[model samples]
Target: MKDNFYLGVDVGSVSTNLVLIDEEKRVVASIYERTRGEPIAAVQRSLILLKEQMDRPFRVSGVGTTGSARTLSGVIVGADVVRNEITSHAVAALDLVPEARTIIEIGGQDSKIIILREGVVVDFAMNTVCAAGTGSFLDHQAQRLGIPIEEFGDIAMKAEKGAQIAGRCTVFAESDMIHKQQVGYPLEEIVYGLCEALVRNYLNNLAKGKDILPPVVFQGGVAANKGIRRAFEEALKCEVIVPDYFNVMGAIGAAILAKEKTKRTGKTNFKGFEAAEMNFSTSSFICQGCSNNCEIVKMKLEGETVAHWGGRCGRWEIGEVERIAKEQVLS
Candidate 1:
C-alpha cells in the first residue's frame, strides 16, 4: 500500500518552511530554509529538499500554503487550501495544546499574540512595525556579540541577573547593548537582558489590552531561545510551553488544514512533486482604479498568468475579463 501525505508550505519574509504530515497528523518530513528575499526559489528548494529527505515513496494527497507569501505559494504549489499566518498558527497551537489560552509567536520579521477561549480564537494582535521583539533582531544581536545563534540560549542561561536594556526599538536596543559593552557589563548578562527587553516590548505592544491566560504556548523561531522563554515566564508569572516543532508550526498547521479541507472535498489540487521543476515568476503593478493605489501582484507559471492578489478590494481575484467588465459597469 502506498503511503499518503499532506504537504504544507509556509513562505515568510525570513524563512520558508515545508511540512509533510501523514494521515495520523504526524510529521513525516519537514524542511526549514531561509527565504532570503526570494520566496519562489525558497519554496522550490524546500520542496526538493523535503523530497530527498523522505526514504520511502509517498503520495501527496493534499497541499496547503500559508504565511506572508501564501497566495504566491498557493499559485506555485496548486494548494488545496490557502490561509493566513494567524489562522495557521492558531490551528497548530490548538492541535498541540487544546487548552492553550494564549499563543505568543515571534517569527523572523514580526510577532503576534493570539487569545483563545474554549478552542475558539477570541482576539489577536500583531506587531509588525517593530523588529525589536522578533527573531531577526535577536540574530543580529548574536552576530554583533560574536556569538553563534544556536548557543545564545545556553550562554544566556549562565547569567544570574540580566542588565537593563531598552526594547522600544531596534536602534535603541543596539545602542544600549553597545553602551553596556563599553561600560564593562558581562556578555551573558547583556544577552539575557536583551531577551528580557524583547519580552517586555512584546507584552507592552501586543499583549497590552488583552487577557493573557494560562497554558501560554510560545512557538516560532524565537522560542528556541531558552533566555527568551525564561524572560517570558518571569514576566507572565506562568510557565510557557514550547512545542518540539516550534519553528515549523505554521507549516504543520497548514498541513492539518489541508487534510481537513481535502477530506470534505474528497479531492485535492496538489500539483505533485513535479511542481518543483516548474518555472514560476511574479510581477506587481500599482492599481489606478482607486485612491488606495493597492499594489497588485500577479503570479505566472510557465509564462502564463495563474493568479492575481494583493488588492484592497480583491478586484483582481476575479480574473482579467471579469475585473475589466466590473470596472466598466461601475464607471
Candidate 2:
C-alpha cells in the first residue's frame, strides 16, 4: 500500500517553500525556491519538483498553504487548510519548542513578532510598511558591498567591533554604510553594524510595547544569518533557538495543520499532483458596482473563474452574480 503524505506550501514575495510530511509527522522532503515576482510560476515549479522527487509510492492525503500569498496558493493547490504566516510560524515554533513564549519571524519583505502564552497566541505585530528590517534590505546591502549574501554572517563574525549605522530607514542606513566605507571602516565592522541595526529596528518597531520572554524561537530566512542570530542573542540577553528547518517553518506548520484538518474531516480536498500541469491564470479588475471600487483578484483554471476576493462586500465574488443570473434565467 502507498503511504499517505501531507503537503504544505508557503508563498511569499521573496521565496516559496514546500514541505512534505508523512503520517508520522516526519519530514520527507523540503524545497525552497525564490519567488521572483511570479508566485504562480514559483508554486508550479515547486509542485513539479516535489512530484518528481517521490521515490516511493505515496498519496498526498492533504494540502495546506500559508504565508503572504496563502489564499492564492490555496486556490492554486486546492489546499485542505489555509493559514496566515504568524499562526503557521507559531505553530511550528510550539512544535519545536513547546515552552516557546516568543517567535521572531523576519521574512523577505517584512517581519513579525508573535507573543504566545501557554502555546496560544496572545499578541502580535508586523512591520510591513518598512523594508529596512527585512532580508531584502540585507540583500541590497550585500549587492552594494559586492559580497555574496551567503557569506554575510561569516564576515560579520570576524569584526572586532561594529560601526554604528542608522536603522530607522533603508535610505538612511544605505547612506550611513556608504559613509562608513568612505572613511575606511573595515567591511566586517560595517556588516555587523548593519546586522545590529536591523535587529534594533525590529525590536523598536514590532516589539515596541510587548514584553518579550525567553524560550524565543527565531525562524525565517533571516534566521539563517549568524550575524543576525548573534545580534538577537546579544540584544535579548538570552539564547534564541533557530530550528533546523528555519527557512521553511511556515510550510511545515501548514503541513501540520493540513494533517490535523484531514484527521478531523476524514477526507481531503487536495487537487492532486496533476495540478502542476494545469493552466492557471490570475487577474485583477476594479469592481464598479459600489463606491468602494475594490480591486478584486480573480483566479481562473482553464479560462473558468474558480475563486475571487478583495472586496469589502461580497458583491464581486466569483459565484455571487453568476449564481443569481442562472437562477433568474431558470425562473
Candidate 3:
C-alpha cells in the first residue's frame, strides 16, 4: 500500500519552504529555496523537485499553507487549511516543546515574539518596520565583512570580546561596524558584536513589556546561527531550544494542521501533484467602490477566476466575479 503524506508550504518574501510528512508526523522530505521575489515560480520549482524524487507512488492526503504569500499559494495548491505565521509558528513550537512559554522567530524580512501559557498562545508582537534584527541584516553584514554566512557563527564563537555596535537601526549598525573595522578591530569580535546588537534590538523591539518566560523556542532561518543563539541565551539567561526542523517549522505546523483538519472532515481539497505543472496568473486591481481604494489581487487558474483577496471590505472577492457575470447576462 502506498503511504499517505501531508504537504505544507510556507511562502515568504525571502524564501519558500515545503515539507512532506507521513502518517506519524515524521518528516519525509523538505526543501528550502530562496524566493528571489517570485513566490509562485519558487513553489512550482520546489514541487517539481518533490515530484521528481518519488521512489514509489504516494498519496498527498492533505495540504496547507502559511506565511506572507499563504493566500496565493493556497489558491494555487488547493490547500485544505490556510493560516497565518503566528499561529503556524506557535503550533510548531508547542508541538516540539510542549512546555514552551516563549517563541522567538526571526525570519528573513521580519521578526516576531510569541507568548504562550499552558501551551496556548496568549499574546504576540511583531517587528516588520526594522531590518536591523532580521536575517537579511546579518547577510548584509556577513557580505561586508568578506565572510561566508555559513561560517559566520563559528567565527563569532571565537571572539573573546565583542565590540559595541549600535543596533537600534540597520544604518547605524552598519556605520558602527565600519568604524570598528577601520579601527583595526578583529573580524571575529566585530561579527560577534553585530550578533549581540541584533539580539538586543530584537529583544527591545518585540519582547518589550512582555513577560518572556523560560523554555523559549527559537525557530526561523536565523536560528541556525550559533552566535545569535548564544547572544539570546546570554541576554535572557535561559536555555534557547532550537528544534531539528527549525528552518521549516512553519511548514511543518501547516502540515500538522492540515492533517488534523483532514482527520476531522474526512476529506481534503488538495489539488494533487499535477498542480506543479498548472499555469496560474495573478493580477491586482484597485477597487473603486469606496474611498479605501483597496488593491485587490485576483488569481486565475487556466483562464478561470479561482480566487481574489486583499480587499478591506470583502467587496471584491470571488463571489463578486460571479455576481458580475450574472449581471452581464441580465443586461
Candidate 4:
C-alpha cells in the first residue's frame, strides 16, 4: 500500500533525529544518530537507517526542521517548514500538555526555557554560553571518574548528601569535582551534588526573572537523566513532568508543525523515502555581508545547489530568485 508521510529533522549540536509521522501523527519510523561534528554525515546515516525500516515505500508530503542547525538541514532536505528551536520546542510541549506553562529543555550543549500561555509562547530563554550544566559536561565528568554516564543518575538517586559545587562556570565545577573525588567522597554524593549544581546553574541562568510554575514539562536529551529531573523537582519545589517522548520531543514537535502547516496550506513539500536512496553532497562558504560574515551553507544535488542557507542576515538563503537578482545588481 502506498503511504503519505511527513519528515521532521532536528539537527542538534550533539545529535540528529529524523522522524516520520503518518497522517494520523503516529511515528511510523524514527532514526537517531550522533552528529559528531559532521551533521551531513549524521543525517545521511540516519536516512540510510530510516530507509531500511519502512515496510512500504512512501513519499514526504511536508518537511519541517528545527534545532541549532535547522536552516542547514532544512535546505539539505528541501524542507517546507523552517523554524527556531524555541518555536519548535513550544509546539511540541503544547501538544503534550495542552495547558503547559513552563518548558525546561537541557541538552548536550545548551539549555532553554519556554513560557506558554494558552498554547502560545509568551517568553523564552536559551543558555548557549556555558557548558557546566549540559549533558556533555556531565558525560565528560562521568567518564573521567570511570563511571558510565547512565549510572551517574542511579548513583545520584542514592546520594545521602548534596554538597554545593561551584556551578557558575564549567571550569570551577570541574576543579570542584576533582577535589570532591580526591577527598574520597561517595560517588553518589558527588553525582547528586553535580546534579544539584547543574540545576542551580540552569535556574539562575535561564529561568531567572521568570515565573516558573507547575504543569511544567521538561524535554530534551538530558531529560532522560533521572538525577536532573529530581534536581528540577527539588529546585522548583513543584512537580515537573517529563513527556513520554522526551528525547524526541523536538522532532515530534517539528512533525507536529509539518502536519499543521500542510493542513493549512493544503500542500506538502516532502520528498519521499526514495530521497534516502539518492546521493547528496553538502558544503559551506562564508559570506562577507558585513561584520556578521555569515557562514552560508549549501546543499548540493548532483551539481546544482539544492539549498543555500546559514546567513544570519539572510545573505545566503536560496530559492529567492528576486534576492539573487538584487545581488547581481548590487555587485
Candidate 5:
C-alpha cells in the first residue's frame, strides 16, 4: 500500500466513467465513455487508457466500484471498496464543499435530489421513471428544434417571451413542443419554457417534501447545460454552484471512497496495471439455482476462472467455476 493512488469506476446504463485520484482526493486521471451496450468492455477500455496515460505500471493502492453495474465491476476488478451512487456522490460533494446543503444531479437517464444536514445525507429522492426532466430528453428536444444542445443555455438566456410546454412526461412534452412550433412560437422561447417547466416539475414532484436549503451544488451531465443551470438557479432562488468536474462527480466520489477505505483498512487490493493487459473473457448464464433465476456473469482469464457474480442465492458465487474446473481435471 505504498502507492498513494486510487482507482474509481462508475458504470451506469448510459455511460462508464473511470477516475484516478491521489491522497488529496483530487482527480489525476479521469476518463468517461459511453456504455454502448457493454459496460465491461467500456470499463476495460477506460482502464487501458488510464494505464497508457500513467508513467508506468503503478500499483493501484485502492479500487472502488459504484453505480448500477458496480457489483459486476467490483467482482471484475477486485474492488477494495464497494459503495452505492448515493454514498459515493455525497462523499465527493462533501469533499468539494464541506457544507453543501443540497445536491441536484441529472444524468443521461435519471435525476436525483439529495438534501444534506451538516455534510450528512438527511433525505433524498430519485426519478428514473420520468425522462422529461433528464438530459437525453433535452437532447431530443434540441435535435427536433435544430439547435445544438450546447447552445441551449444561451438561447434560453436570450428568450424575451417564453411559451408554455407540458413537462409531465416525454410524450406530453414532445407533443407540446410541436404544438408550440405549429403556433409560430420561437424556438428559443419554447426551449426556455421547456427548461423552466422541467425545473418546476422537478421541484414540485421530487423536491416537494424535502427541505432544499442554500449552497446547492448541481452535478451531472445535465449540469453542463446552461439553460438547466439557470433554470435551477431561478427556481430555487439561490446561487447554484457547478463543480469543475460536474459530469464525473460519481467517479471522483468513488475514488475518494477508495482512498478512505484503504486508509482505514491499510490494505491494497488493486490488481495493478497487469490487469489492463490481462486477457479477460466474460459470459452470462441464467442461474436456475433458485426460483429467482438471477442472470449470473462469469469472467475467466487464460483458461482459469476469475470471478462469477449476479447470483442472489450465492450458489455460483462461492468459487463454483474454480471448483468445477478442478473437478473436471480430477475426473
Candidate 6:
C-alpha cells in the first residue's frame, strides 16, 4: 500500500518551489529550482525531481498552489486549494512558531512583511516596485564584487564595523559601494554594510507604521544569508527565527492548507504524477468587454481549455464554468 502525501507548489518570478508533507504535517520532500522566466518548465522539472527524490511509493492525496503563478500551477496540477503568498507564508510561520507575530519574507524579486496577532494575520505589506533589498540585487552585487554569493554571509560576519551605504535603491547603493571600495574600506565591512543597508531599507519601506513584535520569523530565498539575518536582528533588536525549510515555506504552507482542505472535504483534486507528462499551454488576450480591457489569461491542457482568469469582472472565470458544464452535458 502506498503512503499518502499532500503536495504544494509555489511558482514565483525567480524560483519555483515544491513541498510534500505527510498527514502529520512533516515535510517529506522539498525542491527549489530557478524559474528563469519560464514557470511552466520550471514546475515540470521540479515535479520530476520530486518524484525521483521519493524512495517509497506514495500517492499525492491533495495538491495546493501559491505564489505569483498560483492559478497557472493549480490548473496544471489540479490543485484542491489555491492561496495567496501572504496567506501561505503566514500559515507556514504559525505552524513552525506558534507565537510568531511578524514575518519578513525577501525573495528574488520582491519583499513582504506580514504582521500577525494570536495566530491570525491582521496586516501585511509587499514591496513590488523596488529591487534594492531583494535576493536578485544581492546576487548582482556579489557578482560585481567577484565574490561567491554562498560565502557572502561568512564574509560579512568577519566585519568589525560596517561602512554606511545608501539603502533607498539599488542604483544609489551600488554607487555608494563603489565609493566605499575606492576609499579603501575593507571588503568584509563593505559586504556587511550592504546587508545592513538592505535591512534598513526593508524596515523603512514595508515595515513602516507597523508594530513588528517579536518572535519575528524570516523566510524566503534570502533567509539563507546569515549576514542579512544578523542585520535584521540588529535592526529589530530581537532574535529572528529562520525555519529549517526557510526557502520553501510558502510551498510548505500551501501543503498544510491542502491537507486541511482535503481532510475536511474527504477528497482531493490532484491530477497524479501523470500530470508531469501532460501538455500544458497558456495564452492571453485583451478582454475588450468594457473599458476595463483586462488582459485575460487562459490555460489549456491537452488542447482543451482547463482554466482562465485575470478579468476585473468574472467573465473569464464564468466562461470556464460554462465550458465545464457544457462538457459534462455532452459526455
List clash counts for every candidate, in order: 0, 0, 0, 2, 1, 0
Candidate 3 residue runs with Cα over 4 Å from true position: 318-331
lDDT of 3: 0.90
The 10-residue segment of model 4 with minimum total lDDT is: 319-328
Better of 3 and 4 by TM-score: 3
Tell me the spans in candidate 6 whose CA falls farther than 4 Å from its real position.
318-331
Candidate 2's error at 115, in angstroms?
A: 0.8
- The RMSD of every model to the true structure, in order and in angstroms, is 4.7, 5.4, 5.6, 4.8, 6.3, 4.5
Over 4 Å off, model 2? 318-331
Over 1-331, each residue of candidate 1 has an lDDT whose tens digit, in order, gives 7899999999999999999999998998999999999998999999999999999988999999999888788878888888889989999999989999999999999899999999999999988567778998899999999999999999989999899999888888999999999999999999999999999989998889899999999999999999999999999999999998999999999999999978888999888888899988889999998999999988888999888877878678754334433643775
**All candidates' TM-scores?**
0.92, 0.93, 0.93, 0.88, 0.89, 0.94
Candidates in order have lDDT scores of 0.91, 0.90, 0.90, 0.81, 0.83, 0.91
Clashing pairs in 3: none
Sorting all predicted structures by TM-score, with the top scorer first, yields: 6, 3, 2, 1, 5, 4
Candidate 4 matches the true fold with a TM-score of 0.88
Residue 314, candidate 6: alpha-carbon lDDT: 78
- Top candidate, metric TM-score: 6
Q: Which residue pairs clash within candidate 4?
A: 59-272, 60-272
Instruction: Please give the distance, in angstroms, between residue 94's alpha carbon in candidate 6 and its true position after superposition.
Output: 0.5
> How does residue 139 of candidate 2 score in lDDT?
95
Per-residue CA lDDT of model 2 for 15-62, tens digit only, reads: 999999888778899989999999998999999998888888898899
lDDT of 4: 0.81
How close to the true structure is residue 112 of candidate 4, measured as C-alpha lDDT?
89
lDDT of 6 by residue, 2-43 (tens): 999999999999999999999888999999999999998898
Candidate structures ordered by lDDT, highest first: 6, 1, 2, 3, 5, 4
